[model samples]
Target: MQIDIRAKGFELSPALREHAERRLGFALSWAVYDVRKVAVRLYDINGPRGGEDKCCRIQIALPGTSDVVIEDTEADLYIAINRAVDRAERSLARRLERQREHRHARQPVVEITDDDSAEEFEQRADAGVFH
Candidate 1:
């Protein structure tokens, strides 16, 4: 999966990039579908108190399904990113389960052939020429 990190009004450092990549990778490893790409945007939202409000928004792309987005705000960007990624993973799991259930429900059932002895059955059929 490709992880694209974008920082708004701030320069992304190597540490932040690595942290976001590692955290998102670890969190979404169990996803059922191939995450085609992940977009992470970090921004500093203005607060009334003049303190920087860190926000993280993550969009996880799933094949054959809609993308899941989760956003979180915290005093630390890393924490916000971690929380958003976790939420995205949980949402994807739920979506996958629902999709699986829907597909299974639409499956057609086939009858099973219970005959265990095929040779005997064929022999009996052949002998029916006498009957």
Candidate 2:
């Protein structure tokens, strides 16, 4: 999966980017759905009055579903990213589980007739109505 890292007030370094990727990748690897890409944004809250000011936003793309985005602000950027990624992972897991359950629930059950070689069954098969 592709990881896009962007910084607002500060320049993102190779080490930081790699660290974030490693952390996020580990979390997403356990997901049931395949992740197409992850986008992370880092920005420092400019106001002195805002407590827990560092902001981290993460967007995750999964198969057959809309992208999930999580935003968290904390005193530390790493903490914020970790929390946001954790939340995103949990949400994705729940969604994937629900989808799997729905698919199973919607499946039609096939029942075979008692007389395996009956003429009616043969006729149904010949008519392409039963297999």
TM-scores of the models, in the order given: 0.79, 0.78
lDDT against the true structure, each candidate: 0.81, 0.82
Residue 20 error for model 1, in Å?
0.6
Off by over 4 Å in 1: 47-52, 116-131
- The Cα RMSD of model 1 versus the native structure comes to 7.4
Which has the greatest TM-score? 1
Candidate 1 residues 80-131, lDDT tens each? 9888888888887888889889999986543325653676656656665212
Which window of ten consecutive residues has the lowest lDDT sum in model 2? 108-117
**What lDDT does candidate 2 reach at residue 88?**
84
Q: Give lDDT tens digits, candidate 2, residues 36-92.
A: 888999988875565789899998887788888899999888888889888988887
Candidate 1 minimal-lDDT segment of 10 residues: 108-117
